[model samples]
Target: MEFTAALREERLVAIVRGRDPEASFRTVMTLVEEGVPLVEVALSGADALDVIARARRELGTEAWLGAGAVLTAGDAQRARDAGANLLAAPALGPGVAESVRQGVPVLAGVSTAREVAAADRAGAAALTLLPGSVGGPAYLRALRAPFPDLPFVPVGRVDTERAGEYLRSGAMAVGVGAPLIGDAADGGDLGDLRKRAARFKAVCA
Candidate 1:
């Protein structure tokens, strides 16, 4: 499914932005193996696009692989070239709207009221709030107050357990990384996180 539409459909978006490419793959594959419908690979470094391609090939159509942490239109275009079906940015990066117009789903990140307004003006289908630690889901709820149609996805320093709270507090989706994927990501850890993914699913169940 398209990225924005998928968010609208209520599937959790698992973000894979680790300290390195290997960790990112192992972490994301964990969720893919567990039947996660979508995954995000933040374009944090040069190897990020390669990681997205590998994940797409490894998981095939079983999961939708995308890229995040984009800071420019060129980055978004590169993500698409690397097999990213969806594009995300730390904020409304330059040409973000055009990338989405080209068929890449855009989950543009926003941090403040002004940024949110900017993203809306840019036609972002969804917004990813960083440092979810600041206000977490509570702040997200407040952001959605006026723009009830807007989708706010909280990310950063969040764990599997907090996912339930994010959803309960009115977030459209949550982006989980280290807290759930962990620092020791590998096949074994993937197995464990898969179980945790089940727990996340149960919470929304």
Candidate 2:
């Protein structure tokens, strides 16, 4: 499925960032096994590219694996080459354009109306609302008033409750990090992670 369609249909993006390469890769595999349709490995994480490559090799070409925190053209190129079918950035930058040029869907970050318009014009597949909890659902509703057609995936500090609120308020999806991931990426507990993932899927459903 297309990235945007997966976002809308799944309504959640699981973000994995860990200090251990092996742990991070396991965390990603856990999420995939639990049916989290979209997974993004932050490039800031240790050995993120290797994790992406390994996941791609294991999951094959059909899994919705993505690279997050992409900041430059080089980051975009490396991520694509590493087998990420999607790329996400904290803001609209060189990575967005490079991902577009590479024929990969990008989730461009935005906070203001102007930035939203700019990302849209740049051909971002979706707008990622950074620090999404700060403005809350009301802020998302306000942004949607003028750009109703744009796909927005609110990220940061989003819990199961807030995830539903954002979706109801017009966000196409919600990108969850620590809340959903917890310390699973850090080798905390896969059992707990599975429980949380199931809860998120239930809430989003």
Candidate 3:
């Protein structure tokens, strides 16, 4: 399936953000094992490009691995070369449009109606509504009220176990960090990640 369809269908994108590639890989692998089809590796981490390459090589068949925290068009280009199927930014930048124009699916960040409209105009496939806890899911509902047709994915302060609340509120999907896959939070074990993914699936289902 195409990256966009995979992401829109699964509705659970695992984010790998940290300084340790080994640890991050372990965490991501757990999510993959549990059938979480999307993985986001923030580019600021140590050797993130290499990690993305490895992840695509290892998990591309089953998971849509990509880069997050992309800060520039150059970074986005590098991610594309490294095999990221998607690009996720903390903020919307014109370069994000440039990257998406290159055939990379992008989730641009937006906080207000103006920004969301701008992103839509820029051709962003979707928007990532950040700082999710400032107003929680209710804020998402309100944001969607104006752009009822727009798609917004929540990227922060998500209660993975309670993803139903966010989804019902307006989120296209919920990103789960440690709670979905990191062993440090739950013994850093793949089993925990699998179970959590299952639970998320059940809730969303």
**Ten consecutive residues with minimal summed lDDT in candidate 2?**
1-10
Most TM-score-accurate candidate: 2
Native-to-model Cα distance after best TM-score fit, residue 118 in candidate 1, in Å: 1.7
Off by over 4 Å in 1: 19-23, 184-188
Tens digits of lDDT, candidate 3, 83-198: 88788887888558667778778888888889888888888877888766676788888998999887788877566545778888867787766555555322356565677778
Best candidate, lDDT = 2
**TM-score versus the correct structure, for each prediction:** 0.86, 0.99, 0.90
Candidate 2 per-residue lDDT, tens place, 131-188, comes to 8978999999999999999999999899999999999899989999999999988879
Ranking by TM-score: 2, 3, 1
Clashing pairs in 3: 183-188
- What overall lDDT, based on C-alpha atoms, would model 1 receive against the true structure? 0.74
- Which run of 10 residues does model 3 get worst, by summed lDDT? 178-187
Q: What is the C-alpha RMSD of each candidate to the true structure, in Å?
A: 2.4, 0.6, 2.2
RMSD to native, candidate 3: 2.2
Residue 70 displacement in candidate 3 (angstroms): 0.5
CA-RMSD of model 1: 2.4
